[model samples]
Target: MTKEFFTATPVKQVFDRIVEFVPVGTEKVPTAETCGRILATDVVAQTHLPGFARSTMDGYAVRAAATFGASESSPAYLEITDTVQMGMAAQAPVGNGQAAGIATGGMLPEGADAVVMLEHAAKLDETALEVYKSVAPGANVVAADEDVAAGQKMLAAGSRIRPQEMGLMAALGMETIRVFKKPVIGIISTGDELVEIGQTPVPGQIRDVNTYSLAGTVGQAGGIARTYGIVADRFDALRSTCTRALSETDMLLISGGSSVGTRDLTLEVIESLPDSQILFHGIPIRPGKPTILAKIGQKALWGLPGQIASAMVVFDRIVARFVGHISGNALSYRQHDRITAELTRNLSSVQGRTDYVRARIVEDQGRFYAEPIPGPSGLIRTLVEADGLIEIDMNTEGLEKGETVFVTLLR
Candidate 1:
């Protein structure tokens, strides 16, 4: 029996329909080992940073009023009380008409509000010093709570931990950090003419590329790839593998059988599963229009295109975001970098579909230009030659040369 093509849904509307039926759980990990992990709870400061006011210059610490009207012509003199040792408490208080020698980062003595740089003051004698510049209160001094205040919220939940966040947690003496658990994504490729990558293809058979490539992309998005070796197009075999995959993984991806074909059996098997609902059967997205998203139980079961290039584009643009969402990260999470550049060529597009044009970015005379790398979607050389993809809006018909656009980088 043959089937007709279904109405295509808009990409955003399809993406908005995704619900996290099984959200990733959280665990406690060492703050130092939390790089790239999404924070599960908000972080608040435990104590004031620095814990004391300190000087930022190597000079005399004195009251701002004591240095008033002090300049090269006429100098204000104050008695030198004591010297603050490095990494030690202030030696003495700065009484009226009194100054204390302080090094950079030295603790500020009581009654001292500013530091006069060494070059701005002169040592007249062993007990007296001349200030050659006027100073304002709080000048050249770091307040006790300047870096962070106690009880202040520092980091928000759902934030990814970076090297700088590690340093901040260290500064705040945070030992354990709450982070979302890494999600486990299942991958399955269905095609009778596909062979393992280890085996060379003979005649019409081709090497399986989607399983391994999708695994790498899944890892980049913080999900553990649980792969089920290539399954044939038979309904029984594919359904058996998917049953085990969904049982073992947070999400299952059936690569192939999304488009309407005699061999396209993913929709039928997915629909037969208990409590399965096909949220979307097709999307108005160029290069990956034959995509299917079904909710099987509480897990997302995706039927991706069988073509190598189309499968990869769908994973990069659509699948990765869903992985991030289930893992408690932001919905629009993307692994590839994006850059803004001027288009060097005019590009045409259909009105009802969003087009992702592969492009090569080049730098000339300090400015960057995005040059279109035009080719059929199935061409492997097109993926190799392009550094990024330029997205044209579905509402627009075309883009003009010299128009600025954002390119989603693949390399």
Candidate 2:
């Protein structure tokens, strides 16, 4: 069946489209081991934080009214009743004209309203204190539930647990936490021209670059890759491999057949699956325009272009975004920073295809300069020398020197 293709969708639209079809999955894991994973559920406080009115410093805890207006020249002296030890509840309460020796984080005596830090007070004896600095009500103290109230939501579902979240979980005595499960992805490389790496290439055959590059990329994007070794250019063998992969993985990624003749067979194998439907037959991006997307029931199946650099770009842009959605993690590309630069020379691009030109970024004083690295997309040196991509807008004629434009950093 003939299928209609779309002009390249904006990057944002592509992301939203995948997210609409995906939902995060759940897994129970120890909170101690949940670092860097997104939380599956909100973490609510089981009990009051601080749980008591506590002193914030080592000094006198007294009625704020008794110490009001007291200063270095004329200080308020109170009879020291006893000391409140840290981590132990105070046994006695304070009253008028009385003070309690409170250490940092000690439970406050019932009638004390404020604590004077040790730096601002002098101890007269075991029974008396001379306060030089005046303290207001609730000063140098933490009220009950000041940090977190009982049953309050301390963290929300989908939160990316960081060091602070781990510390909070530790403080709450949580040894385990619920998190999203990692998605499983199956990768298959197909081509008669492909041979496993480490084997010397014959005249028309090349090393199996797709399997290793794509497997590593999948791992970095939070999915476990199950690789089915390179399938020869045969319909039955390819179909059986796809069947096995679909049965085992949440998603199947087929490196597209190298020659145009085998492309139809690959699609036919995918279409034979029950309830399978092709989503997109092709994309409108340079070097990767033969990309295909499909759905077998609820599982995603993707066909990537055969060229190495093209395959990597499509996977990084589309497959990685899908993985992030299902795993509840941010997209894998480095955070983008935009800077303007003068084009060193005129660059040509197809009017209808969106192009990602590798460019080197340089800084002079505070201004950023982008110099385009001209090479075929398949060249590894293109990426190695590039700091990031210079997006050539679709329908634009060309870029001329001295025009300021935004270039995104690869790092």
Candidate 3:
């Protein structure tokens, strides 16, 4: 079948369709290693933070009524009854006109409504001090559950655990956390003209670059990638690998064969699987117009572009989304920001197809400028020199120079 045999769906639509087949999986992992993992359940605060009313600074804890109108000329004097210890409750309650020396984080004594810092007070003897500063009720005190209330819901389900999330879990004395399991992805490259990178390339044969790049990309998307090596352009070998990979993994990715003849055999291999159905045969995307997607039972099998750059772009935009959704990390996940820049050259794109133009970002006069890199999409060097991608609408004839546009960063 020719490329005309299939109708292409937009990139965004393809991703939305595939995610319907993905199911959430859960695993219990240690909190120390939970960074980047998605939460499977809501995290509730087990106890109140601080657990008791405590001093916020090194000061004297006294009844607010006793410290009223205290000043420099005629300072209020109070007897220092006791000293509060750290991590322990006050030894005794403060009586009227009496104060207790309390350090930061020390438990506040009963009957004390405020704390006056040491800088505002002077000790005449061990028993009494002249308080020059007046403190209002409940000043400089951290009440029980002030930072966090007991049974309060903190991190919710589908939240990606970050450093701050881990710190919150540690505060609750949580050593283990329940998070979504990483999806297992099986990668297979198929072509007769492909050879390993270490070997010298003969006539009509090129190095296999798609497998390595796709595998690394899968890892960055939070999937466990298993590269099954390059399969020969025979129907039997390709079928066998697809069957085996589908049985072991949640998803399988096959790099399409470049030649017209080999592409038919690859399609036949997918057709042989039980309940296998093609989702999309061609996308209206440039360089990656030959991409395909299929579902074998519950597992997803994707046919990526033969060109290295095309394959990576389609995978990052389409397949990576499904992986993140299944892993339950979609809520807090975000793609790299689009860098604003001025286009260096005019670019043309076909209607109904979104074009990704690779460009190098330059800093001139404290402003960012995007200069389009000139090369065929198949060449790997185009991406190596690109700092970002400038997207053009399908309906636009061409984009003019000096036009401010958003360029999605490669990082």
User: Among these predicted structures, which one has the highest TM-score?
Assistant: 1
Model 1, span 179-277: residue lDDT tens: 999989999999989999999899999888889888988898778999999999898998899999999999999888898877789988998888899
Sorting all predicted structures by lDDT, with the top scorer first, yields 1, 3, 2
* Candidate 3 residue pairs that clash: none
lDDT of 3: 0.83
Score each candidate by Cα lDDT: 0.87, 0.79, 0.83
Off by over 4 Å in 1: 1-6, 20-22, 331-337
In the range 1-411, model 3's lDDT, one tens digit per residue, is: 233423567676776685557555898999999988889999999999767888999989999899899999879999999999887888899998999999998999999989999999999999988999889998999998987899999889888888999998998889999999888899999888889989899999999998888889888878899988889888889989989899889899999663245256767777889999988777766667777788888778888877888887777656777778777875523666777888877887766777778889999999999998888867999988988788776567568988998888874
Highest lDDT against the true fold, candidate: 1
Off by over 4 Å in 2: 1-16, 19-25, 258-264, 328-353, 359-372, 384-411
User: Where is the poorest 10-residue window by lDDT in model 1?
Assistant: 1-10
Ten-residue stretch with the least lDDT total in model 2:
1-10
RMSD of each: 2.7, 4.0, 3.1
* Per-model TM against the reference: 0.92, 0.83, 0.88
**Candidate 2: residue 287 lDDT (0-100):** 59
- Greater-TM-score candidate between 2 and 3: 3
